[model samples]
Target: MNEDERVELVRLLPPPARPELSADRHRLLRGHLMSELREQPVRVRRGRPGRVVVPALAGGLALALVLTGGGSASGPDRSQAPQATQAPQAQPSAGSAPLNAAPVAAVRLLNQAADAADRAQDTTPRGDQFVYVKSVQTYPSTDEATGEATKGTPQNREIWRSVDGSRWGLLVMDGQRRPTGQDLKDPHARPDEPAPHPLGGGWLEPTPGNTGPSGYAYAAALPTDPDQLLAKLKADTKGQGPGPDQEAFATIGDILREQLVPSPVRAALYRAAARIPGVTVVDEVTDAVGRQGVAVARLDSGGVVETQWIFDRSSFEFLGERTVAVKDDGSWRKGEVTGQTTILGRAVVDQVGDRP
Candidate 1:
């Protein structure tokens, strides 16, 4: 096959059962390839009508490199990868007064949260199962014509994701249901096209490994050591967002919000988040649903906005997340909430539309 066909073939194949590279190396190599791609021009065939270029080819190539231990003679130094440690057990301060009493240390709260996560029951779903998550969320919508941003009303959202990235999933906003994943059988369909419906419809392509963070296989494969996890997060998200530290924090929040992470991995994520610079604790905060809770927050590199992950005071369970403007940055006033979400529930189910 020619180069174009070779790339396309790789793209169509299922992802490996386990990544060939260690998580840190995989992310680092993938990040480097992406950086190189950004600096170069993407090549497309002259007459290929309907073939969309796949950016995830970077990940594919990275995976191919370290296959069978061909790329690196010696594996990554295990000593340098973050070592797992037993965190101290600490109880949350009693009652509502502690929520308003004083600002607690970020590390203290994260360690407590990690301990709580470690104590939770561990559930590993089968490859055919789905992860269901329900939440209420709101964000500022910018009007294209007027160029003005307005805060939107809260809306209920629900999603079911394939556990092993091999099945079609469903997304429900308000009351409308929409199918996700690409219809692979359509003659003219692109690989990234969305599914038409759930009934007698086209065959859905497997979910791309790079697309969904909440996929069980993906979450289960993450490094369970905080230092290594942080390293991988930084390498994988190198140049995408505002900054590495901020992006790492946001990535951790994303994983925690909707994903059914293994207990050790969940605890590791919390501990990893504690290592990020600029993380702090807010005395009190309310989620989109008006539930009051304490928050672990970090200021953006610009210092104008702060992102917070809220948690129940007594239980240390994650409640939701919100973003607030810390400085008046033309569009928003200080203390104004720019975005918010409250997670109602999450569980593993047998099918696309099934709930917990």
Candidate 2:
């Protein structure tokens, strides 16, 4: 390759990459007799763009930290002032998908999530890693959270942790109207000083008490398989409801026990299912990533006319879960009652320990 060949080849290069080429590129191309050339170093170096590799696991956590972008107050432009939140309005991009895309991975991921949650339930907190929930709350209406939590509908939630062979640490959230009276009794407990911990240990400081409703609802989650999780949730919730008038599920009387997690998302479905007296899964769709899953149910709660989608198989990764709610006026209002949160995240190293 002579100067002539190099020059011609250089002229054909694209701008961003071409700028990196050497003047010698064109000179050598100018003399090229054939399209084919000998393999050699390119004196003019147009370095390839550096690829940014996403770290699969970070901060001693195994689950990849995939940030869900976007989360601004939706609905018609409201006049009320906005409250601060930890996440950005989940931005909807072309890359995003509806709840039903890639059914297989969705199901698997969901199951894995449930499994993780179950494990978090069992994980003993050790080292820096910690299992915890930030907060949870309930709102009578979307606007019910008018910067005043106490005036809003009732909400309740609790948190427990086990670190470094220690006992379960509990943190019961409080409300202005009816404080659970549960306190952080473990004075020996310490916040994570370093990076995230393994086997259930990573407590990002509580999201401040009385921020804006949204107490710990289902927001405080631990890794668990979707199947087991749903089963556990269903089992624990069986015959459970505040009472009769208050309980969002099958009730004993008018007393609501758990703050109508009402599916929290599939709220309508769960709430309706709760009424069915006996709601259970009938079908499911597997999701990608191989570790998650989702399911559909024939809820006997009401007339069995509704479709409830369960997003967890055993582990709670992320899949599809939705529900419909029925108001007191014999009217039907729909909403996503079931959902999840970053309750606990673990990595291979965190659980297995580092090797030398």
Candidate 3:
């Protein structure tokens, strides 16, 4: 088949079947594509008419859904196991319209941050439907000596919009680096499968013996709270080289491990944030998650504006979050949420605890 034909054929396969392709198939497709670029003829013979052709591997790795980054602190390892845990439950209340009863200061700041992120979202959408992509995870890496901070590869750049706030349409980019190893635009939420979710599952197999899907068992066995998750850091410290300073480092590490990977996890942050003395909520929104509700938090702290989207309002199924911080030099830098643009661009900023 020619490049165009092969591409079209690949597109014809079912979503579930796409990722099962072998390396040879991806190589074949690339070969055909490159050859066609050189004005080569179709290499494969004409098999009667198009027989609903499905290549051995229909889906190309768009960008290697299961792998990325030059460092080992990121990406999935087959031998690694996953943690299982339930997202926390936020302090409940009526929906946004009644947010007047919320803290006055929190209301003010949340509105500001939420507005900024919403604007950013207005400017960008996930991507067109004809696109292909995979999901990955990212964390902030720092310069050891200077303590200088750097923006890391995002798990993915995505936009999900739902009018009634029930269902979400995924706007995904092919090859966008993310903090989780899953398919961003997965169609189904199958049991025990690794796929992206607004409130995604957590990894339990922290062991080298447990890697990727083999070591991963989904759901809430992984605690999303600050205190409960501390064990992971202690356990991870075993044969690996030394880690950062203990208390702050462990706290930050815990934050990085939990924040924005799932809506529930993020929601836990938001609930904790609401309890802060100075912080205020400017806006509050609730969207349905299956049967549960997700609360969008818009608030302010220090000088930066933060926003959080927490799914499973009654629980801590955090969907995602974005924070935009004003710098001391009169400039601005986005706070890391799920390690990407802190602004998901929503009218109300939500979620909290300032991820490291």
Best candidate, TM-score: 1
lDDT of candidate 1 over 166-195, digit per residue (tens): 786666678744433332244565566554
Query: What lDDT is obtained when candidate 3 is compared to the true structure?
Result: 0.33
Pairs of residues at least 3 apart in sequence or in different chains that clash in candidate 1: none
Measured on C-alpha atoms, candidate 1 has an lDDT of 0.72
Roughly what TM-score does model 3 have, to 2 decimal places? 0.24
In order, the Cα lDDT scores of the candidates are 0.72, 0.30, 0.33
Q: How well does candidate 2 match the true structure in TM-score terms?
A: 0.25
Per-residue lDDT of model 2, residues 236-347, tens digit only: 4556643322233222111112211122222222323333333333233332223244443333245323334434544433343233342322223332232222112222
Model 1 misplaced stretches (Cα beyond 4 Å): 1-104, 177-205, 208-212
Off by over 4 Å in 2: 1-130, 134-158, 163-168, 172-300, 304-316, 319-322, 326-356
Q: How far is candidate 2 from the true structure (C-alpha RMSD, Å)?
A: 25.5
Q: Report the alpha-carbon TM-score of model 1 versus the true structure.
A: 0.65
Question: Which candidate would rank higher by lDDT, 2 or 3?
Answer: 3
Q: Which ten residues in a row have the lowest lDDT in candidate 3?
A: 347-356
